[model samples]
Target: MGVTIAIDCMGGDHGPAVTVPAALSFLRSHADANVILVGREEAIQPLLGTAQSEFGARLKLRPASEVVTMDDPPAIAMRTKKDSSMRVVMDLVKAGEANAAVSAGNTGALMAISRFVLKTLPGVDRPAIATVLPSMRGHTYVLDLGANVDCSAEHLLQFGVMGSSLVAAIEHKERPSVGLLNIGEEAIKGNDVVKEAADLLRASGLNFYGNVEGDDIYEGTVDVVVCDGFVGNVALKTSEGLAQMLGAMLKEEFSRSLLTKLMAAVALPVLKRFKQRVDHRLYNGAPLLGLRGVVLKSHGSADVLAFSTALARAAEAASNRLIERISERMASMNEVKA
Candidate 1:
């Protein structure tokens, strides 16, 4: 009777090995949560193991005959893999059998299928991928994290509206500030598309913060950062790579000598807290906003802890009625335009 999430169990890099356990872990933490695992039963059943009995009716398996692989093209996957775990999970959400769908699969395929199946919310032209990131002030929500490569000025304006709604829904912030990502903080910066988008945002009844550079993301200068998919994807990947390199370098430096090793020992607890603060796994789920139903995309290479975080995010979005909030915001924007 509680919220049920349909999971694409065989979608990620580690497939059921990562997803099944993550779902079980999520179930343990959220007593009122239920999961419908969509994958090949033979492969997923083994992973469930003893947890099946322990979890009982809260867990169910819905067999998927095929899988959409990482290398699979979005168009081909959409056309051929109708019964794939990814599509099946989405189908559950469309049928009202599940409150949301979570998948650690091919991002392109997930976006395409979700858009096709669930359709877009009224007044929304396209769906954008929005995720939370650690920031100096606290956290920031950035959108279009690789959904549409070439977006129009109108699309960007919609991204601002949707992103603000998302932040307000999840962070409980009223009128969260929205920033248009650009090369420079000046209004004259960026191309024609961005300039037009900025003008629209300024007039669109949003808490428009004008412009923000790349550093503004980490600085938490704004609650939501909006940009096209190409730029957003590059920024997201660059930050992830930088985080990995920094963590590795710090580890190497701390273990370089006996003195440094002892220093590391003294700083162990502080280091752990620091790691927890910036851990990418803690921010695993990226919500595909503007969709009529809840659809969350996890990192393709996510591990158990990371995938569990995605499920938790999907549950939170479902509970908060994120899609409904976006719809209302879009309707209001349309009324303003009229």
Candidate 2:
């Protein structure tokens, strides 16, 4: 049997335009995978086109009466919009009808609905939005990207353990290095929260690499970077802004002179390759770790390729037994305490 993923068709800014074609493209790429598109039937059916006839059986639809807007408060949506697309998709994952659910919806709503629907693992205090940061050497997993803005030391430690487990499972690292995202490398550089978490992480006996500075994220010094949502969000946005600025600057440089344009012709391939390596959308999806089931949050502005990338990630997360690895790690931690 193939991997099954639940996709929220009405979640992004582009809505079905991005989601439907993305699903079809994924189906084209991975013949064994099944995509369950969740949204209004009328909105999604036409996107499938004539391919709908052959793939209709493989592509299932689960109707969602409403959509949670990007501006909607997460608490209110979770409480009131019980039949929303985010809710329905998460429900499918909780019930095991789907192996994973991917959405480009509001980050807050996605996190809240996922937590409310799937619940956290036994030992986990919260579910975090962990994202993968592409580095010069490889990718590093960063957690609490915007889930809980105010987190405790215990919460940070939990993020460390979860991130470590995830990176290990996905990257096949026997013991992935875990780093506390801090202001500086020294243990005393951060406030009380980071200091305490670093202590706890060291005590937990995992491969703690001490504190890693913000600049270290792209250097790929550690396999997992742990921080609270507030800090992680700032870092994520800053990096994204820088990427955009660099692209714009390169465009200006290429347009300046005829000689530069000739140079641009020679450099276009190299620049395109570098952009692909650093593109956030290329590495857009990451598991909402600590949930009982897999859930991937794609970029809100995700195009067709980004959507297809997320689909592949969802399939990999399921096939690799990510949840099982997390459970095993939790069990090991519990056994040590006992």
Candidate 3:
């Protein structure tokens, strides 16, 4: 499906320098897309430049006077930075002027602004940050990545429904399996909240996969993994840290001596494939699901390739009607409850 995505041009660590180019790259790959670059025109336009002429009306710029910084608190951003690029992109989505919005901005601020501007879909008690992680089965989707810190049993169930809907819409999967992140595989292993959530999931008619441990996340035990933000965020960060440490260790070992250097040369091809398999850039976009519109968050330090991945994710989600899929699932869930 054709889509128009509004980008927060001044958001990430690289600002317009990275975002503008990333949007252009994405547009080249997706012939049916339109992009609006929103930021300080002086900064964005110079970067956008004559290249805009290549795409003509397909590419345009919208000006925003302010920029949201990484240190800004969510409340401060929402109450103060009214004209910030991050907020303006969200406004575009809320206004239906864009099918989706993307930003590599302050996570807390982006979530706060997006939740406030777009509101939650009907029957959605809260929004969740669903991110793709490289896994044994190609990849898997995990949610509540950092959105709701403390979710109730009912909230976990809601995440399952939203996550399942996301996989269904974006990947065209029917009856995607959903698993609750827990202490063990047994139904009785977790705390009251988790145990109750498991029961609710089992009864909710979703393709519940029972409780999965932290290791199960990378094992690709299920299509969607549901957890509260605190746990999910910890898991996400731990994975990132582990990947970085492994890279450092490998570099250290490979450069240790001539013998090791020759060994590394021999293993270079295998290492490259392994790196590609775990490359976070391939899965850079994290959709803030349950919102009224498609809103994606790119890593704050994402390079051009990673940021382009986020833009592509936003367009795919919009094209697949992610919000509509979630709404329909929620409606059916409510009907079952009734």
Candidate 4:
């Protein structure tokens, strides 16, 4: 059987409207893939419509009575929303009914519920959110994206190891180089925690490239960039805001006058290509790395294409045995220390 993915159909801002279509698109692209749509039957069924016949056995619906809202507190959602679509999707993974789970839900709630249900991998102190970001050299994998705001030097080391394994497994890169995200590239430039983390990473048997400044992330100085959640989240949000602002400014410039409009018409193709290269939708899925089972968090405002991209990522992670690879890597690291 192909990899089965459980999708939280009622989780995102757009809810079923975005998810159902995305699931359908995913099924169409991935011939061997199957999806278990987890949400209220009434809410999801209408969206599926007659397409169910087309997908047939490849698509199935699993009803979930409760829905977790974006505003729900992590603790409250974990405690009271046991039957929520997000939790149900994770439950399917735990039950071996699905290889992975995808949700465009509240990030805090998703992380809390996933940790509670799937637990952390062996030797993993905490789970980190890792995502692919556009870089000038190509792309780079960055981790600890808003998962654990307060992380220690040890945690940063673990993030490097986990991020390395993730890139190795998914990108098929051997010994992918890892860089420590810091204020400066010099060894003594950062604070005590970052300095300590850099030392640990260098000795941790990973392909550590020492400290990297903020610009190094887009320069693709390393295959993986590791940092505490606070720094990582700030970097991610800043990049997102910059992308949006640039796009808006470009649109305004293109519409300024007849001359600019003509120039835009001539450059339309190039602009389209550039947009495709940096489109956040193409990289919407951020895996909650270190979890025992595969779980991906899609952007809350994701549309069909973005949600479908997340589903594709979850399937790839499952097929590649990403969790198992991380576990084995951690075990080997422990053995080396011993």
Candidate 5:
């Protein structure tokens, strides 16, 4: 069956300007997917233009009066913005009118609203943000990107289960190995919480790969990396900053001297290939796993390419029954604990 995605068209840095075009691009690429644009009618109508004629019923508009800004608090999103684009998108997913939802709005607000509206899957205490990071083995799924800052040992184990299920659904890996992110690879390392989580993972039914350091994430040491949101968020932001610095340094050095400029010209093709391989935009979508329904989050500062990439991911997850796979995995894990 084709997937229908509800998008928060007015919730992002560019609002409908970037999201509408991205939705259109996503529709064109995925012939089997439909999109519902949720935002103010007056704002979205002009940008949609001829999309109604182009996509017909495949592209729909569900008007929402309020917009949840990037600065809005989670409480405001939950209490005040009943008719917000973000909340409305979640509502659509809950009602089964859309298979999945995507938003590039306030991360906190999105999480709060989604969890409030759809609730977490059975046995899931918290919903985590699982994102794919480029790695030696193609990629690694890491969670909880920025959800629960202070996660308990049990929460880490839940992340492992969810991450494994996600990888299984998307990559069809029967047993995707999971790693617990820590300061060292040894069992003796890390605080009490991490140590406890490690023990739980080893005992859990998952394919636990033991402890992995930050470097192991890019080395593809494990199919999935589990960490608390505080650590995960810092690591993610650090990597992004490092990538930006490296790119800038390379450009500066190449343009410094005539000899270097000539060398850069000769290496332009290789550099272009390198850039394409490491393009963060290609790996833009991060699913808020453990939710009863599927909801993906795009980067708040995402461009058209990044937003479209997120749309594609949301569609794939919905059609492949990501939520069902997670539910089954959680059930098995719960049985194991019992």
Candidate 6:
């Protein structure tokens, strides 16, 4: 049988309008893959339409009565919202009915539910959520993006290995280079956690490239950049906000003068390509590493295209056995056993 994907259809700000369509698109593109959509039956049935006959038995809906809200506490949601789509979908992955689960709901809830249900793989201390950002040099991976706020030196070392493995899988590069996120490129920079982590990474005999500054993230100096969730989240948000602000500024500049408008028309095609290159939504979802099965967190504002892309990513992670590969690498880490 093909890899099955469990989608939290009630999640995301746009709800079924985006989630349902995205799932349908995945079904259309991936014939070998099946989608088990979890949501209220009444709400999802219409989205499937009569044309579902075309896909045959590949598309299936598993009803979930509740949805975890963005503002709800993660612990509370995990406890009380047992029937929530997020929880139910994760449970499916845990049960081996699906190879992966994707959601655009509350980040903490998704992480909490994923951990509670799927648990962590062997040799993994904690899971880190790594998001792919659009880079001038194709794409870059940033990890610990709020899945963890406080991480130990050991955890950071683990993140490096996991992130590197994930980048290799997605970027199709063998043994991708890894970097430690720091204020400066020097090894002496940052607090005790970072300094100690840097030492651990360098001595661990991994393919680490030493310290990398925040500016180097988009520069794509390395395949994966590792940091604690506190720094990673801040960097991710900063990059996202700046990209939005720059897009807005460019639009205003283009509309300012008739000559600029004409020039914009001529440059629009290339500019459009450039804009698409930097758009965060183009690389929206990131995997929550360390879980038994792949779990991708899609942005709450993600559109149909973003969710479709996430589905493709889920397939890649499943086929590549990302979690299993990380488990094997971490098990062999000399420092971990020492």
What ranges in model 3 sit over 4 Å off? 185-188
Q: In candidate 2, how many Å is residue 3 off?
A: 1.4
Q: How do all the candidates rank in terms of lDDT, highest first? A: 5, 4, 1, 3, 2, 6
How badly does each model clash, as a count of residue pairs? 0, 0, 0, 0, 0, 0
Q: TM-score each candidate.
A: 0.97, 0.95, 0.97, 0.97, 0.97, 0.95
Model 5 stretches with alpha carbons more than 4 Å out: 185-188
Record all residue pairs in model 1 with backbone atoms less than 3 Å apart, i.e. clashing. Answer: none
What is every candidate's alpha-carbon RMSD to the true fold?
Answer: 1.4, 1.7, 1.5, 1.3, 1.3, 1.7
User: Residues 184-257, candidate 5, lDDT per residue (tens digit)?
Assistant: 64566799999899999999989999999999999999999999999999999999999999999999999999
lDDT of 6 by residue, 1-338 (tens): 78899999988899888998998888888879988989988988988786479777888889999989999899999999999999999999988889999999999899889999988987787899998876668677989898778899999998998998897777778788889998863665688988899998997767899889998888888888999998999998887788788889999999999999999999989998987766666687789998888999998999999998898899889888887777777777854567
lDDT of 6: 0.87
Write down the lDDT of every candidate, Cα atoms only. 0.93, 0.88, 0.92, 0.93, 0.94, 0.87
Taking the tens digit of each residue's C-alpha lDDT, what string does model 3 give over 173-249?
Answer: 99999999999545658788998999999999899999988988889999999999999999999999998998999
Residues 215-281, model 2: lDDT tens digits: 8899999999999999999999998898889889989989899999999999989988987777777
Clash count (model 4, backbone only):
0
Worst 10 residues of 6 by lDDT: 182-191
Estimate, for each residue in 208-306, the C-alpha lDDT of model 1 and write its tens digit. 999999999999999999999999999999998998899999999999999999999999999999999888999999999999899999998999999
TM-score for model 4? 0.97
Q: How well does candidate 1 match the true structure in TM-score terms?
A: 0.97
